[model samples]
Target chain A: MTKRKMFLRMITASLLRRRSRMLIALLSIAVGATILSGLVTIYIDVPRQMGAQFRSYGANMIILPGEEGSLTGAVLEEAMQVIPSENIVGATPYRYVRLDMPSRQQSFTTAGTDFDEVRKTSPYFSVEGEYPQNRREIMVGKEVAETIGVRLGSSIELSYKPLASFEGEASADWVPGAALLGSSEGFNEAVLNVSAVLDEEGKISEIEVDALSQTENIGSLVGTDKAFLDQFLGKSLPLTLGEDVDALSGATISSQAVVDALNSSRSRENARLSENKEHYTVAGILSTGGEEEAYIYMSLEDLTRLTQEEIMDVAELSVSASAEELEGYAANIQEEYPALTARLVKRLAKSEASVLSKLQALVFLVTAVVLALTLICVSTTMMAVVSERRREIGLRKALGASDGSIRHEFLGEGMFLGGLGGLLGGLLGFAFAQMVSVHVFGSSITFQPLLLPITIIVSMAISAVSCQLPIKKAVAIDPAIVLKGE
Target chain B: MALLELKNISKIYGDLKALDNVSIRVEKGEWVAIMGPSGSGKSTMMNIIGCMDKPTMGEVLLSGVDISKETARSLTDIRRDKIGLIFQQFHMVTYLTAVENVMVSQYYHSMPDEEEALEALGRVGLRDRARHLPSQLSGGEQQRVCVARALINHPELILADEPTGNLDETNENIVLGLFRQLHNEGTTLIVVTHDPEVAEAAQRTIVLEHGRVAREVINENFGK
Candidate 1:
């Protein structure tokens, strides 16, 4: 037999004598190796998937009115002129009102806009019933429909609270109470017809108002309310009706205040939407399974009106250029529009990559722990084998076996265990990763081919570490005492 | 010049003396028997002569080189290259076949020859049983295998510690006959035993009492 063959045979014979004990050690090493391989595979893939999921939600940028901080028509016109028209798909100005759904006691903030432009900008809205073709039809969010007991073809009674501010009496110093009806000025309310119910596609919702009322014709109604105040030029009076809470409540103005705050926020969001018409649109309503679904949608123009902010707040313009050109575009935009910030949000497959990285880290940690523990087991097993064969070792020493030969024998045994376990672990780890991915990520996972080499290398390292201690112990055995039992 | 020599050899275990100032010498081609009752330190003397153990205070000169000054490792080399050992129980590795047991001795030598192993086995009349494992061989056959193993390296010194002690009369006689044949071939031989019959088989006998050499005599008609 060749020297190597003889050495291997010695190891095999020794291991075979105690196969049962060694099998457990082998299994432990294999398990550790498998986990290492599988987890590493996942760590490399998560970011790309996550990034894709985020991209699916279209709002990569937001635009606001100019630094002048005014929503004047002239300002909007100037902003529009500055941005190229070909880049802007749709734009509409927005106005908002606070409405209280008395039946459900739910507050809905409404955004008034040109529905034609709004529909064109936001296409993800899944309308259960046909959308309104004219100004009278109003689309409602699905959560609002469920709460207010209103559906398509149903006319919902929405009371829009009129502003109770007394004009020309230091209007800037006026703080309106919660109840408009019981306040110094009487409450103003209006009603609208529900045209369609929209599913939760990509809707924006606030905490207080229901999402359905975002599209109510709040502008025309608020304008009319202001016209009514123009009629009664100067009046400060608190008007109380009969003992009917439904008709007029006192402290329910907080709900109206919530609706107002929601409306103002929605209008501002709309202005930003219009300002960045190229990058964003009214995707859909965010139902969130809560009472606060009251939100608004607008075309890019309407967002510009409501937000009353700078053009930089709204528009995200992308030039038809290569990756290298993106830096130049950003630089040019920065220099030309010094007030505006241009960021290159690369559509990186980061989400999937991050998921992969995390999975990789987890896999590495698990593998390390497994291999460490297995090394301990292997070390123990080797120690036992060495101790058990002290007499044999001494006899071999006496019979002229070199220290290298003895050490080689034990190393061969360790490597055999490691390699065997690694092979088994690699196969098992692949299956394990597949199972975890399918169960956790809810998708089928592709097996990475590289895990095989990684598993083998890791297993070998574990065996090498595990064998060192026992090999040292074996080397320390005194030949004379061991052989003659002196 | 003596092929093997011991001067003032003594071995002490705590306060008790296992061997006290035991001195002996054997020239080339001589068969010497060391006889003693149990605990007379005959086994200890054999161990020292076989290089299996070192004396506490003594000089073991093999071919005129004092081995007491050699390191334990170098002593092992000396044992492997110069002396061949046989045990009372025929300590052939049981797992190996008869020929393999003989070949095992050659492992210590730098150049092991298969033909030399076969010839050694043939000298001990164990050539026919060469393929049989130690357990499969008869008692006499096992002793012959052990003898073959000891002689395979053709060492200058052969130390047999009660080689036929565990054997029947016929096997003992066969083993003794093999030894006589090997001695005639000019190999120095030392046999440690308490059996008078075994001692009578040797050309000279050394008697020990109380860990000391009591007497040494050359038989006029040894094995006649």
Candidate 2:
């Protein structure tokens, strides 16, 4: 019986003497703590569960340009700032353009897109051959290719249709979208930085660097193209990259590499020269098996070069937002910029909103009721304990125990009961919460480790406060009368 | 200055006066016994001396400090550090073992030590029954446990109210023998009882009648 155990023994002895009372208090406390932990777990995790459920249903929100003009890449960039960056998991812009196939002498609808964004937005894209890399190249859909009687490496002339310039308010807010995506890398400085291209023999070779457009093929500029030059210029050509060359006619030709005469490799024509063209190649074809298969792909820079319109005429933007947040996200965007219209896909958005709101309200109500019951039960039980221990209290007080010491003893007993109850309740609550989640939400719940201390503190507080009147009455007992023999 | 003094002390309950102007002094290490018939205010005086009750008038001085005017907390400290009490009913906390009951006094004073509490119980011949709860002990054994609890704090003054009221002749002899040993070692003792044998063992005897001191006498059998 050290001093510490002396204090603890007094409390435990008293509690153990009245085991039934403390056990009742403990049970009530445990029940209260369990409900408190379970409801809080459910409350915090419901949104995530609902979000996952909604994602399984498909696209949540879409952003369309204002009627005054089509959406620019600048507006898209600003829109990105307003929306949460991580939440916008996928985004792709669409612009419908027209093309003229000279073989048929008729125009057809051509959709312009960023193929990378399209891949994330629609995962179903299945490729046959390759997608187009530049303005001069195009990936003809199976139906379109069959109609045009074209195969791989087939290039069709695209009709030039410039974006109609927006005036007043819409154009006033625009930033050049094409400039945002284009890099301003200096070719001369870049070439100087490349120390050497090593060969298998460990010898160093100096390599020439050429500035290539987004549409240009980097392979065409790498090695000597004398064979290509001869085939294109209709004569055996001499290489004149570093110095002037004399064509067979004895005329001195000042040299810069010149690429001449182009035709699609798969075209039926023997040789049809192009008036003006970009270095282009087919990268890969996307066959989504859906309507996205019909859309042709190209970068915004390629579109600007081909149409001579330095604008991003994005008709619509597909934004990725979670179902629970879609409505709020759209509202935030509409509030910030009144020009744009945000439409919910409505496939699962309505259901997600309704379920989340009701869930939070129900959790709040259940937690409140349980807390009230716990407080009442713990308080009543502690009061009874104090009442039954009046003689013991009076004896201790007579033995030189101060009023404060008496109060601490009883409060310690209450808190000990509370802590025991809380431990039991925390475990019970985690199990209950997990079970509820599995049964109702078909998901596992997360446990908040912080609840253990909180439950014990709360229980102790309630029990101490409840035991006050009884303890005070006990403290006021006259030791003289209690000890006086009858 | 006397180690314990009661000056013009009076206790009243509405119209009834339990004590009236009772004054007495006991020197350091003196053993005194208080004896009286029913309604003689013997118990009331003990209560006042132990700081368990405040007198209606006059004062109690211990070590030259008037304790009757002190606050409840100070009185509690006085009872804890300076005075120990033993009741006829034993008043051992029922749920605690005999050793734990002894430790309770030490706990209230400063610190409780198992060795000190066990030694105190051994002094009263209850060492073998140290782990027995009050309900499990005989009346004599219970009284011995109470004595051990009172002695555990090494109080300056010990007030025994009917100390052997419930004990057999053999247990009474054992208790008196322990008090004789304590008196030989110079511990102040106050025994309140109707038993003449208990009163005769003390150095002085004070007799009360109708809340007043009827007579007081020095005892010849204190050490004998």
Candidate 3:
């Protein structure tokens, strides 16, 4: 230990004696180590942090209900009892029903759910209007609102049609199981002319509805009182309701996908006719930039009342969890809810994995390049030291310093610088990672305990490797020539 | 038996025969001064004797060991245990203080001891300036520190080339007085210089001209 200490002292003295040059090399190593440690930390952590971010895209584990169109019993409650609430951000029940738009003579997708929990589950949805609180309103998504010729507070009619419409006399009304040779004649498109909007009072209001889509032909009808609004409050707004023929002028009325010139998928097959009709006003507009953008949402109570069945249309329940543990969570859910199948949102998980892998690769590449540059800088500086201390080395050699002793001094110096550089770099790298994470990802990361040892090892390895040629040069000095001042 | 011996040693630098057919021997505790002008192969012969360079053709024996065929590592051991060297330039690691510079030799020789280094500095009469860096010291003082460093290893052979060549009259007297004191204590020393006064202080003086020994004189009043 004394010998070691003496060697350390010698190296320390040597370093102090050559501060400027050694400082430059130390700074280079520190910079390199900082980049290495910081990027590695980010590479490992970015996936977890970004995965949490993508969780806002919604569920990683989606548990489908027993049957395709319905859940059995108070099955959602059973599912809740089975799943640990700590892991659950949202466990909402949903019901899907066909919405018949009499104004547009078509059916659309209307979803029924508790909107409050949905806010937590899919927080990335950018809502333009407020969410509905009661059974008397509907939340129309952006694509639906654009496809449908409706905006906030516009009255629409939806008819329930779970099955096919049969051949019958084409009347103003369409009902299921009737031989309705459905023709576009005697169809009385409901014309709601709002006299006044009653704010929680049995009053009158005037509402002028302008059909935004060319397929829609809305006419005005004078309406007043609570009964009028209530009767027209729970209807489904089909995606094709507001088609303004004047806007389309010489064009055909179709869906949002067909409203463009480049849409090749828009055909006559995408249309639907409803057997029964109910009315509701558009209460909200939601924009999510996802599949949820095309949905019409309502409360389950209103949907049940309209369908005249205790309708539990919850076909699936999506649970928010991390990607790594999601599969295990899914398996646990399956063991508990034997009738239900719990599976991961594989596409989302896969894409997130792909992104994380790419980022890790990029960090590795940058780290490698930085390390190479560090080796070159350190090696060059050490070589300069060798050149400067030629006389000193030669003197020591003549004074009976063995090759091992000379090597020991330089090796100690290299390791000391490496260790010091690593320590400084590790701390600075963590700080930099925090800054980047907070600035770019808008979130903070946790500290990794493993980074310390990793940086030290890498720094030491670099230093030792860089010292090889310089040490050889130092030990190879000829005392005779240098003592002669040659 | 001689403490140091060279049998027909020849040192060649490419085409220049720096030392040709030179053979010399010195008994234990002998104080010898090797006198030669520049390029007379004085430095070359010293280098071979000091184990800094191998003789191109000859046998060298130190303390009865034929080390002429020794490898560099073994030569290093011989140099550490039996030989010490000094130069006119006072080649100190300029950054280290006097004490640390002396300790450096001790460090390579064995374990470095701070007290021993201070004692060595005291021997050179630079005890008070032990903490001074080489640059802070006067030229003669730096040379004294180099002397301290060379003696710190306790070698049997101290080979000093131009020990007082760069010193002033008073500094040279002071340095030569230390050498005379060490020689009286029976330390073997080979002082290489062209100064007749420096050679006169030795028990024997060997003169070289053009790489061969020209003359050898025995000094009867070396101490007086």
Candidate 4:
């Protein structure tokens, strides 16, 4: 037989002779390896799973107007383009406006937002009925509906006077410039400089009008137009021609033409003021127990049409990413768009990070404790084996066995046990991790293929280190004394 | 030149002297016996001669190489090359079979040869029991296995310390007969024992008393 074969035979026989003791050591090593593999898997994957779980709570980030003091739909779209789409769960832009209720003599705050985006960003908000589907439909909060004395399907009339400079005073007239009028044949242009004077209570106290028509026959009636425009004095806006004002005498078509010009000028001015008066049906009641319960919500499309501007005050975003990654995205957005401020909701981000880190720390601590205990247990068992074999060691030494050879035998037994236990533990550990993940996190963990080799190497290292003290004790045996029956 | 020499060997254990001013010599192919009472330093002298230990002060020249000054590692090499030891307790590895036990010695000395190891066991009349563990063998059979293991490497000196002490009279005679056969084959033998019959089989006997060589006797009836 070869020396190597003989050596292996000797070590194997020795281990087999003390099967019970060696079995204990093997079990300890296996348990240690199991914990090592399982906990490491958890520590690496917890952040991703926890980040996803936390995203369900609400939006953890908000984008607001920067130094420009105003945000637009185009700017929000541009900012969203820079972020990866997969990371974004939802991003909803919000626009706020206040409209007066003429009959109630009160103003109600209103917010315009996309309902589809809100479902993702603010899943916690519950609507009593349903979100508005059209411009004529609106959703009011519980407090808004209570204050307005309106229910689902009830109509609300809201109005807002034109706040532009041309509304209350004769600052300018609708000239259309000479080129625009002259470009079209048979088109008569008129300049109507109309102004309303309001009292302290916002009631129209007086009205004035100056009309100049480019039509050839209408130029001579400047004195007569004073009487014609005087009929509108002391009247309130949203006035209708022929209903609120008397028609001029004799020249009926000419009078109708002047009235048409007046109505066209007012329509152009009202576009900037955004529909001075409108009626809407209350489609839903929002019952959120927060500030949102006191405001009226509508579609952004309708709000844009009314305000004649595509602008938003702020945008709320829900992203599926860790706090650090969100910070990186926020930094990138701010750098790219100086007029936009991206902020993370610190409470949610910090809580998610804190919980995940603590869980990882706990896993690490448990793994460390298990490994230490395994080392101690295996070391003690090996020491006992060495003690039991003192006479055998002495006999070998007397038979001209070197200290190095004696050490080799004991180390060989230990490493062999370690390798066997490591393989068993690798398979068991993955199952252990899978069970824990499914039970605790309600999700299945991804298997890491690299951990198998790592576990085997670590087990072998533990076994080799555990053998050092026992090997030392074995090598210190004195053949003369031990063999002499002393 | 003497094949083995110990000049003024002294072995001290703290305040007690196990061997003091002891000197002995044996020529090549000589069979000698050492007889002594307990605490007479017989085992201590044997230990030093077998390279298991070093004397406190002495020069042990085996084949003209002073081994007293050798390092522990060098002593192991010298022991494997030139000396073979048989213990009184028959200290065979309990797990290995008889043949494997013999092969262990050959393994440390050089490459193990199972055929050679089985032949060695055959010489000791243990060929039939070659596959039995030490626990399965009787006292005399276990002792024979030890003898086979010691003789497997063809060492220059065979050191047997009370080799038949644990055996019955019949088994003892069997072991003594094996020692005589080996001696006839020109192999050196050193027997440490308290039995007069065992001592009488040797060419000469050295008796120790209280750590010193008190006397030496020659066997009168030779070769006949």
Candidate with maximal TM-score: 3
Residue A47 in model 3: lDDT: 72
Q: For all the predictions, what are the DockQ values? A: 0.21, 0.44, 0.49, 0.59
lDDT of 2 by residue, B1-224 (tens): 89999999999999989999999999989999999997899988988998988899998999889999888888888888998888887787888899989889888888888888899988988889999888899988888888888878778999899989888999898888888888888889999999998999888999999999999988875565
Using DockQ, give the best candidate's number.
4
TM-scores of the first chain across all predictions? 0.51, 0.48, 0.70, 0.69
Model 2 lDDT per residue over A1-486, tens place? 566789999889977876777788889988987888777777777777666555544456667776664576677678767777866546666665554444454334456666666555544566677555555565656656666566677555554422122223321221221110011112111110001122333222222222221111322232233433232232121224333322222111101222110100111122122222343344545555666555455666676666555555443333444454677777887777677776777855777777778888899888888887887787777677666766678788889888888888877887787778777887788888889889987989887778767766766676666667666776777666546675
Ranking by lDDT: 4, 3, 2, 1
Model 1 lDDT tens row, A1-486: 234444454567556756777787787788777777666655444433333333333222223343445344444445444445553444444444445555554556555555554444443345555545542345566666665656556655445433332333322221222112111111223222111111233122112222222223342232223332132222222111221111112323322432333222212212221111111222333343433245433333433333443232233332222334445555554555544444544553233345445656766677667667888877887788778777666655555555665687778888888888888988887787778766766655667777787788779778888889888888766545322213
Model 1, B1-224: lDDT tens digits are 89888999999999989999988889888999999898888877876776767999999999998997776667778888888777665655545567766665675465445577778888887777777866798888888887887777778988887888889999998988888888888888998888888998899999998899989978778757
Task: Give each model's whole-structure lDDT.
Answer: 0.59, 0.67, 0.72, 0.79
What does candidate 4's lDDT look like per residue over A99-118, in tens digits? 55667745566788998898
Q: Indicate the DockQ of the complex predicted as candidate 4.
A: 0.59
Candidate 2 docking class: acceptable
Give the better candidate number (2 or 3) by DockQ.
3
Please identify model 2 stretches exceeding 4 Å from their true place. A1-5, A16-18, A50-60, A63-324, A327-341, A345-362, B217-224
The fnat scores of all predictions, in order, read 0.13, 0.73, 0.58, 0.72
Q: Is candidate 2 or candidate 3 better by TM-score?
A: 3
Clashes of 3: 30
Off by over 4 Å in 3: A66-92, A101-106, A143-148, A155-281, A288-294, A308-324
What is candidate 3's DockQ? Answer: 0.49
> Over 4 Å off in model 4, which ranges?
A64-86, A90-120, A123-313, A335-341, B125-132, B219-224
- Model 4's chain A TM-score stands at 0.69
